[model samples]
Target: MKSNPNFLFPKLASTIEELRQLSISEERKKVLRPLVLYIQRCVQESKTCNLNFICTHNSRRSQFGQIWAKVASEYFGISANCFSGGMEVTAFNERAVESLKRSGFKISSKGKGNPIYAVSFSENSDPIVCFSKLYDDRVNHVENFAAVMTCDHAEENCPFIPGAEVRIPLHYKDPKEFDGTDLEEKKYDERSMQIASEMFHVFSEAEKQG
Candidate 1:
């Protein structure tokens, strides 16, 4: 894997390499094509790439997707902005936070409920600011961005995102089911890796088009 001084941990780089090997099904790949096209058009037009990943809760899959999308975009030398939101606000779940820490992102938090998280992938790079909020929150892009639905419920409910020029249903299985089970930590980590791989696919392909 290529070395990145911006990545805060050596493991982050290697884990991403491992994720690239995971098999993404043809069905999911087809669903992901629109997302790729959106990104390709943005790059070809020299426009800013804004991606908002949404789910029922911003706790798990969406958070992982947002962070990994930014990491992968940077890894591939693509300029992009990534954000995550939910239908309703909820804290970034501790389980998912721990999973990302294990994957080598340096994370810190402030505030109480729905606290803000500063997750850093590399030392010199600015950390990604993360918190749970509505998909239309003022902190995110208000228009001309792609809305990536990371869970089924959000996809079904948010059929239309007013200002989104493009919307993509790139759903994922919720790892929240394993919360209290013996496989809790294992499952959370698995889901994180899954999103990391797919986001890597998204941005890596975008880089090629650029």
Candidate 2:
């Protein structure tokens, strides 16, 4: 792993390569490829491609999106910053952290009572940290970045994001539906794998262009 101060954490080269082999949806692949390439070009040119993944809870889908984007960008030799936030005030859910860990993401617990566990893809990458804040908490703060809505609710409700240069809707189903069930872990893992697979496919397409 190599570190980049301008970016949050260093890129995890190996993991990104590994993820490129995972299986995912064709529809997702179709959209993610060109989008990722555009993002990568922006970052490589020293432009800040600030990506904000937003969901209703910001516990699972958006969190996964944020982490995978960071890992994918690093693997493809792209420079970009990634963050995750929720439409409502909610801490990073423990199940999501556990799921990511199981998927081989190197994570660390930073604050008391787990404090949402600051997650990073590799030692050099900055942890996917979050504040228990709302999407609109600091109106003008994230104005120049891309506003990516990762769930249906957030995408529909947040039609207008202040200061956002581009608004993209990338929706995923809530894996929380399996919470408390006997197969909860399996379901989370499945969801995580799906996300990982899609991200890899996106970057693989980007790699082909060069």
lDDT of each: 0.86, 0.68
- Highest TM-score among the candidates is held by which one? 1
Q: Give a tens-digit lDDT track for model 1, residues 5-66.
A: 34546888777768889999888788888888898898899887999999987888999989
Question: Which residue segments of model 1 deviate by more than 4 Å?
Answer: 1-8
Q: How accurate is candidate 2 locally (lDDT)?
A: 0.68
Where does candidate 1 clash, by residue pair?
6-122, 7-122, 8-121, 8-122
TM-score for each candidate, following the candidate numbering: 0.94, 0.80
TM-score, candidate 2, is 0.80
Instruction: Give the clashing pairs for model 2.
Output: 9-125, 9-126, 10-124, 10-125, 143-163
Summarize candidate 2's per-residue lDDT along 69-169 as a digit string, tens digits.
77666766655677777877776778888887766666776665426566666565566665445665562146677787888899888788887777777
